[model samples]
Target: MSARLGPGRTARTVIGVVIGGLFAIPIIAMVEFTLRDGDGHSLAHWAALFDPENARQYAPIWLGLGNSLVLAVVAIGIVLLLLAPTMILITLRFPRLRRAFEFVVLLPISIPAIVLVVGLAPIYLVIGRTFGTGIWSLAFAYGITVLPYAYRAIQGSIDATDVRTLAEAARSLGAGWGAVLTRVLAPNLRPGLLAAALISVAVVLGEFTIASLLGRQNLQTALVVVSKQDTYAAIIVSLLALVFAFVLLVVIRLAGRTQGSAPRTARRAATAPSARAESPSDPSDPSRKGNNT
Candidate 1:
């Protein structure tokens, strides 16, 4: 068996390396491009980004980065606090409505960003007045844009999990809705929820047309604006953004895998006592038999 698996494992590892190289090559090229400086390569472009004199020129990028981060947080909030619960409720309570709800949730992805913005133009007029044009208000639009992606992630997880059974079991154990959600449902759904959140963040950060058309600043818009001026600086920022996203995804995966372990441990501990109590112990052993007598 080990011999059979050895070849398969090596094949898989080789495939993985090839795929990783395919992705890493472009990023490596981008890094090399930014390092170019006429006669020689150097970190001058990167270093200039932090230099005091050039600070104001990069201000828009900073502002846009901050806005994008805020939008990511708010968009994740919308997905978790609103979209996720609606999906869970549909799964557990309103199975019949699932198809219609899915259609509504997924409609945005089919529509182009420009068309969505055209439709949103009027609505944002009201929103602008009501919300005073804060960058965070973009979350409302972002929430819609990210819904399709987030929904797929969360729904996949929900489908894999027997959420109905878990909910019912928790309720039978006298857990309230809040308790059940926090203690039972949340732990099980953590993987899907984290994946959905990460997807939403990725979508928000990469977004350009919608933010550009909406006259809002975001990371992509800032990159475009910076690119026209200090091209190398723009590339550096793009490379850093890519690296940051990669790291963020790695950390989130690690967190999703490692978290909720304590609850599993506690559950095991709780069940162990019951198992020992229910089982008859060592009746065949001579010491046990003598003690009983």
Candidate 2:
């Protein structure tokens, strides 16, 4: 078995190394640029970002970062609140509408960002007139952009489980629609909900076109502004953003894995004693003979 597996393992190792190196190259370059200052290595640019005195100078970046963070939270909330219930309702009550719902969710993907921006401009103007152009309003558009991804993640989870039966069962037990959704369906779809939230947050963080065109400052726009003012600082910020996104993805994956494993662990714990009970007693064991006696 070892001999047979050797070549495959070696190939996989080599492939992994190559892929990691490929991803590392740009990051390595960014780090080197950020560290280089006047022929010597320094963290002055990075330090400038956090310097209290420099906060006034970096107002745009600070404001942009703050806006992005707020937008991410709002976007995630909107995505889950909008998609989760709609998806569940469709799955449970309007099964025939699934195809149409999916088509609508996916329509955003085919629409070009520039075109979408143009289409949304008039509505945004009306919104700005009504709500006064708070950057958080961008979350509505971001929510739309992330809708397809969120829908697919939740839909996949719904499809994998018997949501219809669960809802029906909950209803049969005198549970209201609200209770059935919150108490029964939500717990089962935790991983999918988490995945959707993470995906939406990531999308909002990295988004530029909508925020930029809509006259909003977000992380990506802030990075662009910082780039013009201080290239090294921008590079550091970009690298940090990349690292944060990677870490978020890793966390989502780990959470999903843990959620998936819990049931299996419980099943094993429940079955082990039963399996032992069903097994034939060993005649050679004095303890077994005594128990029988």
Candidate 3:
């Protein structure tokens, strides 16, 4: 079996390398492009980004980045707290409404971003008047935009997990609904939640159309604004943002893996002591009886 699978494994590795190379080439090209200067390649453009003298030039990018971060946090909180709990409720209680719920959650994606902006523009105008035109208000639109991806991630986890059984068991133990949802169901859903959150952040950061049309600045919009004048610096910042997102993903993946393994490790520890205790007290064992005698 090992011999048979060797060729297949090699093919998969080859395919993965080719796919990865396709992505890495553009990034490599971008880096090389950013380093070009008057005489030779230099970090001059990159260094200029942090120069106190030129801070004003980069201020818009920084402000946009800060706004994007705020949007990410609020959007993530909205999705996880609101969408996650709602999913669990619908799954456990309103199972028949699954299709309708999915239709509503996923409707945003079918509409073009520009079209969504058209509808959102007026709503945000009202919101701005009421809430005073903060960039954070953009998060509501982001939350709606991210629902499709977030819902898909979380719904898959719910399906794979025995949420009904888990909730019932918790309730039988005298836990309230809130306790059952948070303490019992949420942990089982962490992988999905993390994945959904990552997707949300990525979508929000890369977003341009809605933010542009809405007259709000985000990371992508800032990059576009900077690119017109200092293309090299904008490219550098873009690369950095991509690296940040990639690193965040890897860190979350590691954290999720660690969290996943913890329960199995704990279960093993719990069982091991019992197995050892039971072995010696097995009266049917002649060796044990002889030793006691």
Candidate 4:
């Protein structure tokens, strides 16, 4: 006889299925629309994605894509370096500060990007006007704006890690704090780091409000440039962004699975041999279960 799922689990499963369909349906429709030809289903849009004329018309597409990638990588790296240590420190040394830190970290979400852009414009204008380099300026903006998402992702990871115990164990083993953090905590926090990095990338790639408001020539700006002239290409750009987001989801899922499975495997490896050694008779082993306990 099959075991029955509990009511709560059944309800959750139903809700999950509904939500999944709600998201998937629109994506499927977009793909269908993008692929449909003027005459019939065709590869024109997909082909146009690689065309030289398309690039010329959408000059910023290439530039914006490159800028976006750079922003994502740098922003994600900065976030991990800054927030990981901060989270660990807060959780380990000053647990009481967590609420305050969280409140401050989450302030970005409460403030509109438009407001942030307006506030930062004067400062960035001076730096850019003086230095004649908006490259680092834009990157810094992207990185700062990504803080809330990145912080939450990493903070959740740090919280789940029981970093205090790990750090103590490492110290007992004569490892320095740096060594402990790099080896023990970072490895365990990989999933959260992956999620945070991808989120930062997604945010940077799709961020139009701040970049446009700041008059920065970024990916979002490029999208806007083409969007006014060619709605079709704009839709294609949107499709490509969706594809990137889907790829990010896959990466996060795989990372989560790898991280989640390690403890189970380690436990089995550590316990199975001990169980065998402790058994006076063979019965406890599955191979000899019929013989004895």
Please list the residue runs of candidate 4 whose C-alpha ends up more than 4 Å from where it truly belongs after superposition. 1-29, 261-293
TM-scores of the models, in the order given: 0.77, 0.83, 0.80, 0.76
Q: In model 4, which residue pairs have backbone atoms overlapping below 3 Å?
A: none
TM-score preference between candidates 1 and 2, better one: 2
lDDT score at residue 177, model 2, on the 0-100 scale: 89
TM-score, cand. 1: 0.77
Model 2 TM-score relative to the real fold = 0.83
Question: Candidate 1 lDDT (Cα, whole model)?
Answer: 0.75
**How well does candidate 4 match the true structure in TM-score terms?**
0.76
Ranking by lDDT: 3, 1, 2, 4
Model 3, position 49: C-alpha lDDT score: 88
Model 4, 1-293: lDDT tens digits are 23454457678799989999898987787778778887788878778868887678767787888877777777877777887788889988999898778667666655677788888889888878788765556777777677666665565456556789989999999999889889988888776777778767777787777677777777778877877977667778788887987787566555655555444322221122122222332232222111000
Clashes in candidate 4: how many? 0
What lDDT does the true structure give each of the candidates? 0.75, 0.74, 0.76, 0.69
Give the alpha carbon lDDT tens digit for every residue of 151-171 in model 2. Answer: 655655675568889989999
Model 1 residue pairs with clashes: none
Scored by lDDT, model 3 comes in at 0.76
Candidate 3 TM-score, true structure as reference: 0.80
User: Candidate 3 residues 79-190, lDDT tens each?
Assistant: 9989999999899999999877867876775666788888999999999999998999899989987777677556655765788999999999999998998889988877
By TM-score, rank the candidates, best first. Answer: 2, 3, 1, 4
**Regions of candidate 1 where Cα sits further than 4 Å from its true position:** 1-26, 248-293
Clashing pairs in 2: none
Candidate 3 backbone clash number:
0
